[model samples]
Target: MTTALAQRPPATAAYSPPSYGLVDRVAGLRHHSPGRLQLILTTLLTLGLLTGLVAGLTAHSASAGTADLGNRAQPLMVEAETVYSALADADTTAAQAFLAGGLEPAALTQRYDDDLARAGTALTNAARLVPDDSDAARAVAALSTGIARYSALVATARANNRQVLPLGASYLAAASQLNRETLQPKAQALFRLATDEISAGYDAARSSWWLILLLVLSVALGVALFWSQIYLSRTTHRTFNVPLVAATGLFAVLILAVGVLFANQRTHLDSAAQKGSAPVTALAQLRILVLTERADEALTLAAHGSADKEEDFERASGAIYFDDPRLAYAERFTTTLKDRHEAYLTIHGQVRKLDKSGDYDGAVALAIGEQATTTFGDLTTTLDQAIDNRKAAFTDEIGDAGDGLDLLSVLGPLLAIAACVLALLGIRARLEEYR
Candidate 1:
């Protein structure tokens, strides 16, 4: 059997898949027709850049917040504490010298001078750190003016006391009033402001949820790209795409590392704020209260018949001993303070009674002589010990917080860059197969 053969038809033109030059491909991207290889490349590149940018920005913010918490906020708080203590001690020392009459010890005189100088320096330093338009700056300015007036009043009181003038007591009382009513409150406000700033830094550092979300998106994109490579391999009958695999693995590792580091930093910073900074602030306020009470006691002695000073003392002491909720955190410290303060108040009552019963000499002896050992002296001693303990605790907690953030700032951006580069290389390698 013979089979008949059919003639082939002539082809007019060889059919070709659409081809694009570099410029055409670039233009096609804008027009949304850059073909599969360009689209994949562009998507991978864009994702990598976005992921890297997010990581870098987040890392920078975290680093800045951490730095402020450790360096600026803590130091400002310390300086504020110094300012409060120095001003209070100066007032206390001046009163003691006044009570000593014209025979004021040379050591007490030197101590008063030193305290004033230290307070002045600390205030200046704090002012330099704060914004010029801020409330802290205004408070420092007010304090500067108040301290000058205070010095003049104290000097006048000293001169009058030397000449055995009763007006000396009035001048001392005025200075103490200026401090308790105006200057001390301003100082306290400044301290509170500094604590607020530290709290803000902590909040900023803790708020990394956006970064986490970005990481999640990047991870999801990485997984998708990785599976796309698997799809490509299956369709092309290839074994693997090494670059894509590496990119995915690097992204996974980077995200995991960032999450862990961020979590740890947040934990430590939160602990510091809760256990360290907050308690220190409370203790500092308590210290201010103690100093104010001490100053009031002395001023009342100077004022003699004035009920206002005594009332002020009662109110101030009541705020700390009975009213403030913050003291609940340090029950032991608060209890110790209460006991010492109650004993001091009892001695204070006896001193007042002696003065009122026509025993000026006895009142003076009880206030500044041997009887003071169980009253003002005991209260100050216990207060000092408590302050020291709180300070030590603050240091330990803040130090631990700082230690936790040591590695994050450097590692975060680096991993991000690595992930970005690997992604670009992976997509480029896949695209080269088409070429």
Candidate 2:
């Protein structure tokens, strides 16, 4: 204690723990038969485990995405479409009522009211699906705010019309302008977002990279199992190890089954996109265009500005006439929509002729007459049915896509573990003989 530093044992080398060189150890183990068997066991087990994990995870993800496609994405798009269509229909109906001088037709009034009600209900439903503070949410909010202002304008228009005031036409025109310019565009934007989500969802649900990875691992393990068998037969002069053989057979069967299921899911996903969402989108756009045309037709007469700036209507009609572009994407109700649309166009021509000939009252009668309403109603009903059919197709295909996925999610990993255990047992037996 008097001179601890001097008395202290001359500083020995600091205590150090042994450190292994992992690569060197691995190198030492790879040269002999028993060491090789151990390495093979480890490699095969790792591959099997990886394959199992990827397969299980991919199956679960695909199943969930497909379900969401059927449940959330498509339904939200349909709701947004309903909002757009209903708003345009309401505007068209309102314009028609305006054209009928005093005390508008009860039927027209009723239809107009129903259209607005439908729009409001659909907007609420859309709000449920859209995330808050997103573009879709903003659009929904804008639509909500605009509707009240639009309705007030319509009410003012109606009041003035009932009293034979010219200002009523201006108000009706303003309301229509607001709907066409502000509200319908927002609804369409919401719809476009929903459709874009569907497109991206299909790619995510496919999980193609995971499928390829699982496939590669499965094949590598299978080849390793084969090579191990061959090496054992050459080294031990034995034809087969029953456990290893059985394990190989099981692995093959699992791969085949999973491959079949993966193929089935991909097929269903493609069909859902093609026969369902694609058609649904094309038809929705066509229907929206038709509604716009109807609104413009009534607005044209009401405004009395005298020139046909119906470029939108012309483009829509040309697509209908050529049977190309929009209608080409969806086929079921093409004939019905086209026939009704053509009939309406012919009637619209007569309405325009009467107006140009100075038979203004007669033009108004034909424009809001039973013929026009029936034609429009027929086309609308048919389009609705077409959309419903496509939606059902989407749901059915998505349902098919999800089939067996849940079972595979659990079963795949279990089979992989079982095969790994069997292979390990066979290799360990060989190693024991050496010991």
Candidate 3:
């Protein structure tokens, strides 16, 4: 029994771990030159293909986004802003024209019509750009309905005023209320929505994630191709592999060219926002505030003894001079506006004094007189010029941003594919020697 137990193998030795022969053979492959070359070739080809495809898709997507911003998104946003500004001007013109008495001045009448025409054109353009299901479209629809009603009210007010009816003032007030309370709010909403869409588009145009992945894969592929050349040079006593060298040079140039294109696009986008869109929006708001102030001046004379008249004027003045933001491009205009505003305000104070002293007729003349007209008109004209200038700048910058993007989108994939073919040819030459 003792002999039999001693002859038995130990428990650990009785069952040996089974050899996975295929896996062992595969694992041992790294020690051979052919195996090493195969590994390098496979890695380089995989990286090249992945980098190429991802780079192509990312370029296409970014180019599409840039084009959308320039052609569709930004134009829509600017049109909405223009609609907002024109509507406010029309409301102000209608109010002041009412105060100009029975027939109203022909100049003022023409101005009111022009303001409406401008607003209508901008609204039509915005509507064409926005999708029917979007909030911007709904806002446009609301403004269309509201403007018609507001215009009808103003017409009724003018008719009653021609006959010197007391109801004329009430109709005018109703028209102003509809414009300020309803129409302007809807226009502003459309502007906000359009701005949001533009912001999203800018982000889509500069997809950093895709670019980052491309850069990483490109470096890996480049390194593998380079190392394979070194390995061949050492093993085969050859100093250079032409195809591999060419592949490396092609990839390097691709990275540099694309890097520059992306960087330029980013710069143009930033300039568009800073020097164009941002300043344009700020100046538009300022102009609207000025228009509201002018309306208050006219409406106060048309119907006095209101508690909020002077307070509203002061609030608007505060916003224009202190509360409202100013941009670099608008600095000169802002200064001119403030100086002109002070002169207008001085005239306004004199008009108020006469009205309080019971010279209502004289007060009306000074309020709508030549001096008041010139000062206000100058401010409006200058503001319009500034807005136009910024808009032009925006167009130019956006155009530059979108330039060459389409070519790059197509070129990226072709270059990567070419690089891969060269790498394969280079690797096959080494592989043929072993076979």
Candidate 4:
């Protein structure tokens, strides 16, 4: 089959037209058409993101700060109390030994001496940790003087008793009076100050909890606003401005993460306080109660055995005033001391009976054997056990509290960085859609 070939005319030289006259108009229309809404949204989102991120970081920092106070400040305060307690115990023991009229049993006397030395050393160490020149510091200084005076009086009493002089009872009475008047009130004041410090720490921690919730709410609202913009632009067959979406998403994630971490830290701190620290405090109080009772008992025995004027005995054995440090810290001590005291009274009754029957040696033996040897020592050991147990509990909980806060401290900043990066990527992708 023969096909007829059609010749195509040569293509006319391509006609060049002059560039459009309204170039500016075309450019302006392209710039103004969809850009206003996109620009507004993107700017709003960016500002919102920035606000959220800043607030989130602030909240996280606050939470960490509160945790630190709880962990560091409160523990130091507790340690101060421990040192004070040890000092009081030492002073009480010394008074008891002085009451024995002659030099006390070598071991008992040594304990009193050692305790005094330990208390002095402990006070020095505690001073280093305490915030300088606070009420706590003043109290510690007062207590140190009281302890020193008490020790000197006890020594004088011992020297006089050794010489078989009437001065012995007077010296013993002075030592006990010093303890009741000067040292005990200062110690109690220190304890109260420490308690206030810890309570303030707890308040700071609790306050951060509300901040986390507010941060979360802010993040949620920012995210939802960004999402609404995205939906509107997509249904209209346009890309929502990339910067706005990116900024919003970045901040939303940052704030959300911060809020979550802050909440977690708060919970951890609260748990530590409730389960570990609170129980320990309760146990510590119980131990203090027992020790106070023992101290009172020793003082009672010393007063009874002393050969002195009735006024001397009354001064030596009088009630430890409400302002006394040990007495103040242990308000329930009176009841606890009384409870333990009945046993000592029975021994006292026996000692009196022996004396009435013209058995001076037997009475002395009974007083030393029953009252000094078994009951007082046993109760002191129990108190020590309780104190040690609670201290351990507080130590363990502090570790956990630290771990929880450490995690929270780092997580907020990391998430915020990630959110910013993600938002930037999202915005870049939206920008490409327009092209």
For each candidate, the alpha-carbon lDDT, in order, equals 0.71, 0.83, 0.81, 0.57
User: What's the CA error at residue 10 for candidate 2, in Å?
Assistant: 26
Task: RMSD for all candidates, in order, please.
Answer: 11.4, 5.0, 8.4, 15.8
Candidates 1 and 2 compared: the better one by lDDT is: 2
Which runs in model 3 stand beyond 4 Å of their true positions?
A: 1-35, 159-168, 322-326
The most accurate candidate by TM-score is 2
Worst 10 residues of 2 by lDDT: 11-20
Clashing pairs in 4: 42-244, 184-324, 184-325, 185-323, 185-324, 185-325, 188-325, 242-427
lDDT for model 3, please: 0.81
Report model 3's TM-score to 2 decimal places.
0.85
The TM-score, computed over Cα atoms with residue i paired to residue i, of candidate 4 is 0.67
Model 2 segments beyond 4 Å from truth?
1-20, 131-133, 155-171, 306-309, 325-332
| Candidate with the greatest lDDT versus the true structure | 2
At residue 143, what lDDT does model 1 achieve? 90
Clashes per candidate, residues 3 or more apart or on different chains: 0, 0, 0, 8
TM-score of each: 0.81, 0.88, 0.85, 0.67
Give lDDT tens digits, candidate 2, residues 381-405. 8888988888888889989988998
Clashes of 1: 0
Ranked candidates (TM-score, high to low): 2, 3, 1, 4
Q: Please write out the lDDT profile of model 3 over residues 47-67, one tens digit for every residue.
A: 888887877877787788888
Worst 10 residues of 3 by lDDT: 321-330
The C-alpha local distance difference test score for the whole of candidate 2 amounts to: 0.83
